[model samples]
Target: MKKKHNDHFLFYSESKTKNRITINGQEKQHAIAVLRVEDGEHIQITDGQGNLFVCEVESVLKSSIECNIVESWSVKRITPDVTIALGLTDRAHFESAIESLTALGVKKIIPVIFEHCRKPWWDKWRRYEERFKLKMISSMKQCLYPYIPELVYPTILKEVLEEDKTHMIVADPNGSTLKSEIRDKQTPVTCIIGPPGGFSATEISEFNRTKVVYVKLTPNRLRTELAATVLCAQIIGHTL
Candidate 1:
């Protein structure tokens, strides 16, 4: 069986049994219309939950594609399980950050509503949740990654900081360098990136009171999205 190097080469589906998997909607359309795969052709599929199924096309329907699983295996989640608590920014920036973060294999993402955050954006976060989800999915497939980072609902920065967690790192301009802080760390980490206009004075004081390590990604300031992608890449490098 010749393999096709099309975007639909790897499909995603959550509806699967022991031996069969059914893909519908956009995934089906990509397979049937874009890739134009025929029955009996083998393709790769992921459930976006760390499982990859090597399936052979069984039937193509008007609205769905059926395949028989010939082989399957699970991919382990990235170690040190890094979660990024990014302060909410504009829709374009937030979406771009998640796309880069997802491709970098972030385990989870939490949209934070910091004191300086744009209140209007957070107030209507739910309305754009689906669009954000689709962006993450597209990034995952583009990278051929097996898992989609868990996208948590928007939460206030104060509440996020209050959560009982260890190994918390916050991005700050006056903080210790990234190299110095993350060295020799061997535990799950949650990195926080402040939104535009930076964290407020009150928020800075809140950080001072909490047990969080502040890391300076660079000598100069970075936009919220770049800071997040850079931070995530730095952590991933350290983990490796």
Candidate 2:
């Protein structure tokens, strides 16, 4: 069998098919200073909006480089409309959760501020997003996935519960097994996991009133990040 050609490439919105693509700004720096891609080499570019282009380098220069598009295709790889809302935790753990969920093919991620959440790191929110996007891009490249997960600004936990209409499952240590709670369900699902200290009594009551089912992962308690991963895995399996 002949080897298959890699046709899917991601580029910026400004890049055009016939025009020479001058890779500049931060992307240029990374390509030249870091990856050291040379002229005549082929690469894939995406607009991060499902548009992909295959291109070959025409010239390489400091701060900028030019490329010619050889072929192009639109991608349609996206997970089912399953969203995840996670209570804000420490920066390190939260970063892991964001990257893991993005790699797992989540549609949207909302950072939830719960009653037991630590003080908000308002100033570093943008940085967190940048890091998450970087992770998503890397995962997209590795997994050959076309769709990028959207990260929503942090919101109050109650607000998410009120706004959510899909099947909601809250990871609770004192709740029913996830397998039992989610088995045979075919609707779009949204999972919520609380912070390290867990949800307060008042918050639990609010979620209960909203008809959010509490699902437990295991008998032994797990960290907030771990719980989120477990729930996401289960949801993905159901969708598959």
Candidate maximizing lDDT:
1
Cα lDDT tens digits for candidate 1, 1-240: 545334445788989988999999888887778788788788899999999888888888888889999889998777778899998888889999999999999999999888777756667777988788888888988898888999998887788788777789999887887776665545778999999979889988888899999888888899999999999999888868
TM-score to true structure, per model? 0.94, 0.81
Clashing residue pairs, backbone N/CA/C < 3 A, model 2: 9-45, 10-45, 10-46, 11-45, 11-46
Q: Whose TM-score is greatest here?
A: 1
Model 1 lDDT, full chain set? 0.86
Any runs in candidate 1 off by more than 4 Å, and if so which? 1-8, 183-186
- Name the weakest run of 10 consecutive residues (lDDT summed) in model 1: 1-10
- lDDT string for model 2 (48-99, tens) is 6676767788888866778887777887544455688988888888878877
| lDDT scores of the candidates, listed in order | 0.86, 0.73
Candidate 1 residue 1 Cα shift, in angstroms, is 5.4
